[model samples]
Target: MEVLSIVLGGGKGTRLFPLTQSRAKPAVPFGGRFRLVDIPISNCINADFRQIYILTQFNSASLHLHLSQTYVFDSFTRGFVEILAAEQTFEHSGWYEGTADAVRKNFIHFRTQNPKYYIILSGDQLYRMDLKELLSKHRDSGAAITIATTAVSREDASQLGILKANKNNEITEFMEKPGPVKDISDFKIPAELRQDKNGKGDEYLGSMGIYVFNAEAMESCLANELTDFGKEIIPAAINKLKVNAYLFDGYWEDIGTIRSFYEANLDLTTLRPKFDFYDEDAPIYTHMRNLPPSKMNFSNMNQSIAAEGCIITNASITNSIVGVRTIIESGSSLNGVVCMGADYYESEIQKQQNAEARVPNIGIGRGAIVKGAIIDKNACIGEGCRIGVDAIPRVDGNYGHYYIVDGIIVIPKNAVLYPGAVI
Candidate 1:
C-alpha cells in the first residue's frame, strides 16, 4: 500500500517555556543527543515507511535545519522526508489553528502523493511502534480510521483523550481530557482486553495522538471547520465512521511540559531506563557529528550518560546526562542534572575574549554544584555556582537568565551566569 506519514510539530510549547523560547517544541534536545522529533521519524524509518512530511509552524528554523541535515534519503529511491511549513496562501492565510487545520491546509500538497493511507504522529512524544503492524490491523479490520491507544490510570486518563472500545476493538465513545470530576467509569477497557486483572483499578484506553487514516476518511473528516482531531474530528468520526483502536502497551511519554521533560531526561541516566536507545536493531538516528570520544580526567561518574567530545575534570557526576562538546571543570558536582552541551568548543582566542568581556565561557566552571535541573545548550555555569541545591524555595517564573518551572531550575540557551551565582 502507498502510505504517507505526517508528524504534527506542536504549537507554541508554553508549558516548556525557556527551552521552547527560541526553538520549536520538536527541536528541543533530549537524551543527550537526539531531538524530540527524532523518535517519530526514526519509527517511520524503521517501519520502512519513509515518504514523510513534518508539519510545523512556530519557531521552525532549528527543526528545519536539523531535518535537512539528518534525514536525507537515497537518490535512487522515491522515499523522502520533507517539511511542510505553514504558509500564507490565497485560500487560507492564518497559521495552523490546530492539528486538523494543519492537515486540511496541506491537502493540496498531500493529494499529489496519492497515498492510500496516512499515519498521523505527535512530534513531542517518545515511543517506538511498528507502523507495519498498525497498518496490517487497520486493513484487516477494514477501519476507516485507527487510533493507537494505551492503557492508563484514571489520573492519566483525565489528562488525555479517553475512549471506549467493544470486544471487536471498535471505538464507541471518545472524551477529551475529562477532568477528575468526570465520571468515566464506562470508558474502561473491556475485561478481555485487560492484561492484568488483579482488580487494582479501572483501566481506560488513552489516545496516543497517533492515528492511521484512510485517504478518503481523512479528507472527509477535515472538510468541516473542525480544527482539532481529539477535540472535534475523532469524536465526530466515532459516531459516523468505523473507527477502531489498536491497543498498545509500551513505554510512551509525552514530553510536553518542563517537569515531564526534566524527569524523562533524568530517567535515561538510570541503570535500566524504560526507554532504551541501545537497541541497535531499530536505532534512533540523528545528525552524524563526527566528534571524538569523551575524555574524563579523574572524575567519578555513576549512572550517568556523557555524549561525545566531553572533557570532564575531577568532578563528581551522578544520575546526570552531559551532552556533546561539554566541558565540566574540576571540583564540580552534578546530580540529577540534564546538561545540553554547547554547539561548538570555545577556541583559545574566544576564551581570551570571554575573559576580557568578564563573562563565563560555555559549560560548567570549577567548584560548581548542580542538582535536579536542566541546563540548556551553550549555558555557562560559573565557578562556585549553586543551582537547585539551596533550601530557598523558588516560585515558578522567569528570573532573567534562568527560570523555575514545576520546581525545576531551567537555564535557557546561551544564558551566562557569572562567578558565585546561585539559584
Candidate 2:
C-alpha cells in the first residue's frame, strides 16, 4: 500500500521553555547525541516508509538545519524526509491554530500524492514502532481510521487520551486527558482487551498520538474544519465514523515537559533503561559526529553515559548523561545532571583567541558544583560556581545568560556564568 507519513512538529512547547526558546520541540537535543525528531523519522525509515513530511511553525531554524544535515535519500528513489513550515498563502494568513488545522492548511500539497493511507505521528514522543504493521492492521480492520493505543498505568491516564474499545476492538469512545480516574468509565477498555498475558490487568489503554487514516476519509474529516485530532476531530468521529483501535505493547514516553524530559534522559543512564537506544537490529539514527572517543583522566564516575569527544580531568560525575564535546575540569561535582554538551569543538586557533580574550571554552569549570540540572549546549560554567544547589524551587527566571525552570538550572546556548557565581 502507498502510504504518506506526517510527523506533527508540535507548537511552541512552552512547558519545556528555555530548551524550546531557540528551537522547535522536535529539534531539542536528546540522549546526548540525537534530536527528539530523530525518534519518529528513524521509526519511519526502519519501517521503510520514506515518503514523509514534518510539519512545523515555531522556532524551526535549528530543526531545518538538523533535517538538512541528516536524512538524505537518493534523488532517483523518489523518497524524502522534508519539512513543511507554516506558510501564509492567499487562502490562509494565520499560523496553525491546532494540529488538525496544520494539516488542513497543507492539504493542497498532501492531496497531490493521492496515497491510500496516511500515517500521522507525533514528533516529540519516544518509541519504536512499525508503521507497516499499523497499516496492515488498518487494512485488515477495514476502518476509516485506526488509532494506536497502548496500555498505561492509571496514574498516567490523567495526562493522556484514554481509549475504550468494544469486544471487537472497535473504538467505542475516547476521553482526552480526563480529570479523574473515576471519570474514565466512559472510555475504559473492555475486560478482554484489558487482560494481560499474566492475567493481571490494571492499566488502561492510552492514546499514543499515532493514527492511520484512510486518505479520502481524512480529507473529508478535515473538510469539516476540524482543529485537533484528540481534542475535536477523533473524539467527534468515533460514533459517526468507523474507528478502530490498534494495540501496541512496548516502551513509550511522551517527553513534552521539563521534568519528563529530564527524567527520560537520566533514565537512559540506568542499568537497563525502559527505552533501549542500543538495539542493533532497529537502531536510532542521527547526524554522525566524527570526533575522538571520550578521554578521561582520573575522573571518578559511575552510572552515566558519556558521549564522544569529551574531556574529563579528575571530576566527580555520577548518574548523568554527558553529551558530545563536553569538558569537565578538576575539582568539579556533577550528580544527576544532563549536560547537553557543546555544539562544536573549539579549534586550536579559536582556543588561542579564547585564551587571548580570557574566555573559557564551553564546559563545567574548576571547583564548580552542578547537581540536578540541565546544561544546554555551549554553556560555560565558571570556576567555583554553584548551580542547582541554592536554586529557587519551581520558579522560571532568566539570569541574563542562564535560566531556571522548575528548580533545574539551564544554561542557554553559548551563555557564560562568571567565576564564583551562585545559584
Candidate 3:
C-alpha cells in the first residue's frame, strides 16, 4: 500500500520551558544524541513506509537541518520526503490554526501525489510499532478512519486524548484533555480487558493521537471546515463515520512536557528500561559520524552513556547522558544529568558577563558540580559552579525565559553560567 506519513512539528513545547525557548520541541536534543522527531521518522522507515512529509512552523530551522541530513528523499526511486512550512496565500496563507488545519493545507500536495492511506503522527514521542499492522487492520475493518489507542492510568487519563469505543472496537466518542472528574465508564473494552466478559463497563481506551485515514474520506473531511482532529473533527464524526479503534499494549510515551521527557530519558538507564532503542530489527537510525571512541582518563564514571568524541578527565559521573565532543575537566561531579554541547573556552577571556558566549561543545569546568538537571547546547560553566542542586529559584536576564520546576533546573540554550554561580 502507498502510505504517506505526516509528522506534526509545530508545537512550541512550552511545557518543556527553557529547552524549547530557542528550538521547536521536535528539534530539541534528546537521549544524548537523538532528536525527538527521530522516533517517528525512524518508525516510518522501519515500517516500510518511505513517503513522508513533516509539517513545521515554530522554530523549524534546526528541525529542517536535522531532517535534511537524516532523511534522504532525493536518492529514492518510489519514495520522497520533505518538510512543509506554514505559508499564507490568496485563500490560505496564515499559519496552521491546529492539527486538522495543517493537514488540510497540505492536502493539495498529497492529492497530487495520490496515496492510498495517510498516517498522522506527533513529532514529540517515543515508541516502536509496525504501522503496517495498523494499516492492515484499518483496511480490513472497512472504517473511514482507524485510531491507535492505548491504556493509560485512570488518574493520568485526563491528560490524554481519550476515546470511547463499542464492543466491536468502533469509536463512539472522543474527548480531548478532559478534566479528571469527567466520567467515561460507559465505553466498552476488549474481552481480554473487560472486568466481566460480554459486559458493559469499558476500560476507556485513550487515543494515542496517531491515526490511519482512508485517503478519500480524509480528503472529503479536510475539504469541509475542521480545525482539530480531536476537538472538532473526530468528535463530530463519531456518530456519522466508521472509526475503528486499534488497541496497542506496548511501550509508548508522549514527551510533551519536560517532566515526562526527563523521566523518559532516565527510564532508559534502568536495568530493564520500559523502552529500548537497541532493537536490532527496528534500529533507530541517526546521524553517525566517524568520530573516534570516547576517551575516559581517570574519569570515575558509572552508569553514564558517553557519546563519541567525549573527553573526560578526573571527574565522577553517574547516570548522565553526555553528548558528542563534550569535555569534562578535573574535580567536577555529575549525577542524574543530561549534558549537551556547550561553549566555554574562547580565544581570549570575555570580560562582559553577557559577552561570554556559548561554546560549540559542552564542558564541565574543573571543580564544578551538577545534579538532576538538563543542560542544553553551547552552555559555558566557570570553575566551582553548582547547578540544579536545590530548589532555589533563578531567572535569566529576560523574565520569560526559564522557570525551575520541581527542583530540576533547566539550563536554556546558550546560557552562560559564571564561575561560582550556585543554583
Candidate 4:
C-alpha cells in the first residue's frame, strides 16, 4: 500500500523556554546527540514507509539541515522524503493557524500524490512503534480516521487530549486540555466495556495526537470549514466521518515543557525507562558521525550516557547524558545533567581572559563546575564558572543559566558565560 507520512515539526517549543529560543521543537537536541524528530522518522523508516514529508515552520532551518544529512530517500523508487514549509502557493500566505490548518493548507501536495493513507504525527515525542501495524488497523476498521490513543491516568489527562469512544472503538467525543478528573469520568461509555484492563475501561483512552486518515475523507474534510484538528476538524468530522480510536498502551511522552524534557532525559538513565532509546527494532537515529569516540581519562563517570566523540578529562560525570564531541576539562564535575558539546578553544592550556581575547566557538575552561544542569550545544564557558549551585534562581536571556524549579540546570546554546558567574 502506498503511504505518505507527514510529521509535524513546526512548533516553536516556547514552553521549553531558552532551549527553543533559537531552534524549533523538532530540532531540539535530545538524549545527548539526537533531536526529538528522530523518533518518528526512525519509526517511518523501520516500518518501510519511505515516502515522507516533514511539515515544518518556525526555526526550520536547523531541522532542514539535519534532515538533509541523515535521511536519503531514493528517487528511483516512489519513495522520497522532503520538508514541506508553509507558504502562499497561489492560495494563502500566513502563519500556520493550528495543526489541522497546517495540513489543510498543504492539501494540494497530498492530493497530488493520491496515496491510499495519510499518517499524521507530531514531531516532538519519544516512543517506539510500528506504523505498519497501525496502518493495518486503520484499514481493517474501515474508519475515515483512526487516532492513536494511549491509556494515561485520569490525573494526567489534563495535559493531553481526552477521547471517549464507543464499543465500536469509534471516538464519540474529544476535548483538548479539559481540566479536572470529573470532566473525564463524566463522559458516557457503555458500562459493559467500563471494566477494562485498568477497571476504567475506555475512559482511559487519551489522544496521542497520532492519526491515520483515509486519503479521500481527509481531502473532503479539508474543503470544509474546519481549520484546526483537535479544536475544530476532528470534532466536526466525528458525526459525519467514521472516526475510530486504537488503544496503544506503550511508553509515550510529549516533551512539551522544560520540566518534561528534563525528566525524559533522566528517565533514560533508569533501569527500565518507559521509552527505550536503544531498542534494536526501532533505534533512534540522529546526526553525530562527525563526533569523535568518547574518551574517558581517569574520570569518575557512572550511570552516564556519553554520545559519540566526547572527551572527558579529570572531571567526574555521574548520572548524566553528554552530547557528541563535548570536552570536559580537568577538575570539572557534572552530575544528574544533560551536557551539550563544549567549546574547544577555552581549554586550560589556552586561557585568554583579556577583553580582546579571541574566544573559541565551543569551550569550557578548567576549574569549571556544573551539576544538575543542562548545557545546550556550542556554548563557551570562561574559567571558574559555577552553574546550578546558587540558592537563588538565575533567569536571564536565552543564554542565561536557569535553575530548574526541580533542580536541573539549563544553559542555552551559544551562550558566553563570563568568569565567576554563579548560575
* Model 3 TM-score, 2 decimals: 0.90
- Where is model 2 more than 4 Å wrong at Cα? 180-182, 190-192, 195-202, 355-358, 390-396
Give the winner by TM-score. 1
- The regions of model 4 sitting more than 4 angstroms off are 188-203, 288-290, 342-361, 393-408
User: Residue 185, candidate 3: how far off, in angstroms?
Assistant: 3.4
C-alpha root-mean-square deviation, each candidate: 1.5, 2.3, 4.0, 3.3
Stretch of 10 with least lDDT, candidate 2: 193-202
Q: Which tens-of-lDDT digit does each residue in 253-370 have in candidate 2?
A: 8998888899999999999888899888788999887889999999998999999999999999999999999989899999999999998877899869877877776799899998
lDDT of each: 0.92, 0.87, 0.78, 0.77
Candidate number achieving the greatest lDDT relative to the actual structure? 1
Query: How many residue-pair clashes does candidate 3 contain?
Result: 11
Per-candidate TM equals 0.98, 0.94, 0.90, 0.90
Which window of 10 residues has the lowest lDDT sum in candidate 4?
396-405
Model 3 stretches astray by more than 4 angstroms: 73-76, 187-203, 342-362, 390-402
Clashing residue pairs, backbone N/CA/C < 3 A, model 2: none
Candidate 1 Cα outliers beyond 4 Å, as residue runs: 196-202
